[model samples]
Target: MTQAIDRVRQALLQAGHPDTIAMFAEGTHTAAEAAASVGCSIAQIAKSIIFRSGETPILVVASGVNRIDRAKVGAALGRKVERADPAWVEATTGFAVGGVAPVGHLAPALILIDEDLLALDPVWAAAGSPSHAFRTTPADLVRVTGGSVANVKA
Candidate 1:
């Protein structure tokens, strides 16, 4: 496994999550690709989106089928947020944009989870590499990341 994937695995284990990481040769770079690879609905993919509020990185774990409402997020945080650049995402999360995981970020971040994801029993998230992913529940995600569930869907 790559160093990024290893860090994610270690973070999951330290958080008491029991799921195993799965690597796909074809890659899980997009939500559609990940759902197809995992044999799940598009909404079951919990995509981690990173945004920037000034110098701070904010993580929004949204359902695959839903678009995050930046206005809502900004309102919740009382700060305006913009899409983070690719390099900033990598620097902030210690993973590439397409492979940013909910946990194991390199820098401190305020994490927010989409409320829609909570309705799904099992969800898939990126595992620090474009080819890696893991299964998890929304509640478990919140637990591991210490994130708040909100209406992030647009």
Candidate 2:
């Protein structure tokens, strides 16, 4: 398969995100790295965290500043939540940990968008590669991921 970044770019385009995918010379493997590269606040970086709910993968689109409360996740999903390992993250999303986008999954997973992101405009998210990012509004993210708005932050 081609690089996951390309798939992310296509997904963004197809989902009607206003901005194109941005690739930095420096890798955005972490929210702090992406923040430094994009000149945005760390809070403005959206991280896609995948957790296993039995057989299903749940993608939590959260702000960099917040830690996902797994207990809250369980409450939201009404099931036990298990963290996905590196191999599972890759196999489920077709992207590595630092590069998972909110869309273009190999299969659709239930998504939860952190309510914190809604307070900020023009947040940046991983574009299927550690070196690529995309600018998007919280509304667009909800649209692209078909995510539900929730307080998943800790």
Candidate 3:
């Protein structure tokens, strides 16, 4: 218990989101598994995605059930958006691909939130660990991440 809390705290501090950080082990890595562990609907999970627009990296916090439309992303970012590989995700976010949180990242990323997510009452986000996640309101996530809520998909 202490170790989990400590890991979460360190991750939050490193990402500059110490106030909003929470962690718990899900015993699995899939979004479905996480939602089950956290007692939430799978759609409530926000999947963090890292995409590259040339040399610039952008982070998208999208709903679990939606797929990001590349054309829309490119239009929004005003650049060609390509799905970044795991290495790029890790390099840019400091968290593993499966555990990238909305607010805590190794570096500042151009963060975008899927507008659909705002409709959910309590959204779940990763907590810097593949097996962990937490619940928070969409408004709080938007404010803490400084993310612009937008249509991220079709």
User: Each prediction's Cα lDDT score?
Assistant: 0.91, 0.88, 0.74
Q: Which residue pairs overlap in candidate 3's backbone?
A: none
Q: State the TM-score for model 1.
A: 0.96
Go through the candidates in order and give the C-alpha RMSD of each one to the true structure: 1.1, 1.3, 3.4
Report the lDDT of model 3 for residue 77: 71
Task: Name the regions of candidate 3 deviating beyond 4 angstroms.
Answer: 1-23
Best by TM-score: 1
Off by over 4 Å in 1: none
Stronger candidate by lDDT (1 vs 2):
1
The alpha-carbon deviation from the true structure for residue 63 of candidate 2, after best TM-score superposition, in angstroms, is 0.5
Model 2 clash pairs?
A: none
TM-score of 2: 0.95
Tell me the tens digit of each residue's lDDT in model 2 across 1-154: 2468778877887877755688887888899999999999999999999999876889999998899999888888788898999898899889889998888888778889999999998899998888888999998999988898988888
lDDT of 1 by residue, 48-85 (tens): 99999988999999999999999999988888999899
Q: Kindly list the per-residue Cα lDDT of model 3 for residues 1-154, writing each as its tens digit.
A: 3343355466555545534444455442567877777778888988888888766779888888888887887787777888899998777767777777675565777878999999997888877777767667888778777888889876
